[model samples]
Target: MKVNELFKEELKVINMGLRSFADDVKSQDVPVLHVDWRPVAGGNKKLSSLLSKLKSK
Candidate 1:
């Protein structure tokens, strides 16, 4: 479909990591799914690697 089709569709948002943005969208009566998300291992490389290894088990 054309890019303009996106504008014609209903606006729904999956807002991750920012409640304020979801709130703003909800204020405009748009559907929003807010997710409380953060970077893996708090942006630490070592811990992220460790977690990734564990997930492979």
Candidate 2:
């Protein structure tokens, strides 16, 4: 094959890859909300015991 043909094929592959990546980025560009909890000072023994019991079961 000629070098020009090979180069064109590589460019096509790269263009396709870039388009796919751009589509993915655009799809995930929305803001997201997350929830989390923090333990109180010294922690709650009742909550800790419940968690341990749930894990064992």
Candidate 3:
């Protein structure tokens, strides 16, 4: 599947045919599954990096 990486999320590309009611009714029964990835980096690391680079007020 052509996947894009952004917003720290992975998405599956669905075809228009699969979205139609006729396809759902006439086609063989199929199941769709979704998988999610967990964050590898801690929140503190991201915050500290930003804080270190913050422009002085």
Candidate 4:
């Protein structure tokens, strides 16, 4: 597909980790898929690394 084709299509957004952003985008009447995402271990780097290692195995 060409870059111009993307501009012709309707705008859609996948807002992750921030509901406020999704709400802001929705105010413009655009399609949005809001994902209430967060870090695996509350943004704890060491624990997240350990969990990632476990998941890989």
lDDT of each residue in 1-57, candidate 2, tens digit only: 688786665332112223555455446753322323346334788878888788899
Which digits, one per residue and each the tens of the lDDT, describe model 4 over residues 1-57?
A: 677997999988999976999999999999999997888899999999999999999
Cα lDDT tens digits for candidate 3, 1-57: 324454356432334333464345435444433224333345578875676577443
| Rank list by TM-score | 1, 4, 2, 3
Candidate 2: pairs in clash: none
List candidate 3 segments past 4 Å from native.
Answer: 1-43, 55-57
Task: In angstroms, give how far residue 41 of model 4 lies from its true place.
Answer: 2.2
Listed per model in order, the count of residue pairs whose N, CA or C atoms clash below 3 Å is 0, 0, 0, 0
TM-score of each: 0.65, 0.27, 0.20, 0.63
Q: What is the lDDT of candidate 3?
A: 0.45
Error of 4 at 54 (Å): 5.8
**In model 1, how large is the Cα lDDT of residue 1?**
66
For model 1, residues 1-57, the per-residue Cα lDDT tens digits are 676997999988999876999999999999999997888999999999999999999
Error of 3 at 24 (Å): 75
How many clashing residue pairs are found in candidate 3?
A: 0
Worst 10 residues of 3 by lDDT: 31-40
Collision count of model 1: 0
Best candidate, TM-score: 1
